[model samples]
Target: MYSTSTQKREWTYTPEKLAAVRLETNIKFREKYESVITPEELELFVTPEEELRMQRSIEDAALKFADKFRPHIWPSVKWTALAFFKRAFLVWMVMMGCFYLAMKIDEFYITIDDFVKNMNVGDPRQNAERILKLEPELMKVLNYNLTVHCPYRPFEGHLMDMKTRMLLLNFDLESIRRDSMRFFQNALQTDVLLVYPPSQIALAAINFGCMLKSDEILREFLRKMIGIEEDSWSARDVRPEDLEKLEKTVTRVNHIMREVEKQFVAVTEQERENHKSRLSQIQNLLPILNERRKEAWRAGGCIGQEPGLVTEAPVDSDDE
Candidate 1:
């Protein structure tokens, strides 16, 4: 009965307890063998010790075999080692793929940053943190709009040519008219209102407004330009000569509009042959007139100056 009870108690030991006993026995056995062997021959007769050394040797051999092993060795130990190597290689491949994807994402971000910096009206680098949040497509759109609509003095040459060829020739006239009008409006809202002038913004708005036959915006912009000229004057001194010159400009613009209207009337009244011939003559003359206007503005050095433009309001010392 006592032997049976002891056997039942041994059998009742849990898996956890049994594993702990095995680990303890292994440790004790290793310690005993290490103590018996001479430090020199400790490399030799220990079963667990020799088994560990053999395992390390096998691993090294497997690594060397894996390096040289080929697919031709079908049912051999070298093939078995190759299988282990292939599994390790598959894991490495997956890791490399993930790393490449991450790098591509980083590259996309850098491209977007460069585009925004290039397109910015002000120093885009100054707003690097904010600009980084914008997508690449939005940056492209902004750049396109700015290039097409923003007026710089350099663009005056191009605009003059485009206007004469497109407007007077009446080639894609409606599209040109619409683009010119929208460009003028965008220039006014973006360049004029936002940035200090005499800048490309104001120049672009003025030129576009003039091209589109938008009399109201054109007149307003001209008035603003005149105001700039006034502010540039040392005092409120309105020289009679300057005033006369300003009046002459206003008259000239009005006369040009009248001429355009008269030409339209004549085209309606005349025979097709006469009308076509007259329109051709007008087109030939338009480029010469455009060049003359550009030269006059250039000689006067009044290309960007508004007659009475004020960049900012004067601060009152009394307020401070």
Candidate 2:
């Protein structure tokens, strides 16, 4: 005999509660029939007519039990039962099949989105950095492909080549700085595969400068890159067109090498000055860079030959 609470409430029951009830019922039946009925006799007792009656009794008991405790059993039992049914082998197989089909439907869209997002038209370095962070193997593949397919300028080719080399080198900070400088010099001399403004170039230089412990140069580069002229070419309006012109004006590999030499001098560490071996490497690289810059200047002479190519639209004095 069980007492029903007058307090009407929502139902909830745990698996343990149901299991306890089943165990208790099994024990009671065993206690009541064990002395009078042997196992064989008990089996015989459940004849077809008796079996039907027992089934009805079980059903009635279950209904009564549910009615009495439904409020207490509604929450966990409902979800648990649903989960059990949902994860049945046949049900799970069907669900998985549907899920796979849905993925297949949008597979092409997903591929396109991935390509566009990764191959974004902004700075290749930014894209490479992001891809290297997220999917290093994929970045490696891209680096390899770019190196193989594109070999127009050796310095630019080497700059593109460094992505894989950097991944492999595991270099110290000093080495990384040196390599990054070399790469940037090479990058600047090449034809604009991706058109970036001086501001963007300045940003990259600043980032690289910071990494190289050259905060002063970084700041200066940022100022120049963003068109805040101090002394050199101060009167020139540094517009987007000016930046594009600058790109064309520096087409010779030599021009890039000279700028690289200038930047290297601007950014080299005072502490690193005492390191003879490193200093010698820097010294060796300087002449090479200057020669490259001269070559670049000669190549880009055609652009410079056109007067007003570097000049840009005047800034509004009233707006300023």
* Strongest candidate by TM-score: 1
Clashes of 2: 15
- State the lDDT of candidate 2 residue by residue for 1-320, as single tens digits: 00121100111123354335445544554454444444553443223333223322322332233234422333223222222211221111111122112223223123323332433245655644543353423212222111111111332333333443334433333344454444444332221112222223323432443454443443343344445556556446556675664445334333433344443322123432333343355446545544554555567774443421233433212100
Best by the lDDT measure? 1
Q: For residues 1-320, could you state the per-residue lDDT of candidate 1 as single tens digits?
A: 21233212222234355445445544654463442334554333234333223223333333333334332222222222222222222111111121112223223223434433333244656445343433232323222111111223323544454455334342342344445434432222111212122233333433444565544443444444454352555535655665665566555555433332332221122343443354356446545544554555567787775422335434212100
Candidate 1 has its poorest 10 consecutive residues by lDDT at: 90-99
For candidate 1, the TM-score is: 0.20
Q: Rate the local accuracy (lDDT) of all candidates.
A: 0.35, 0.33
lDDT of 2: 0.33
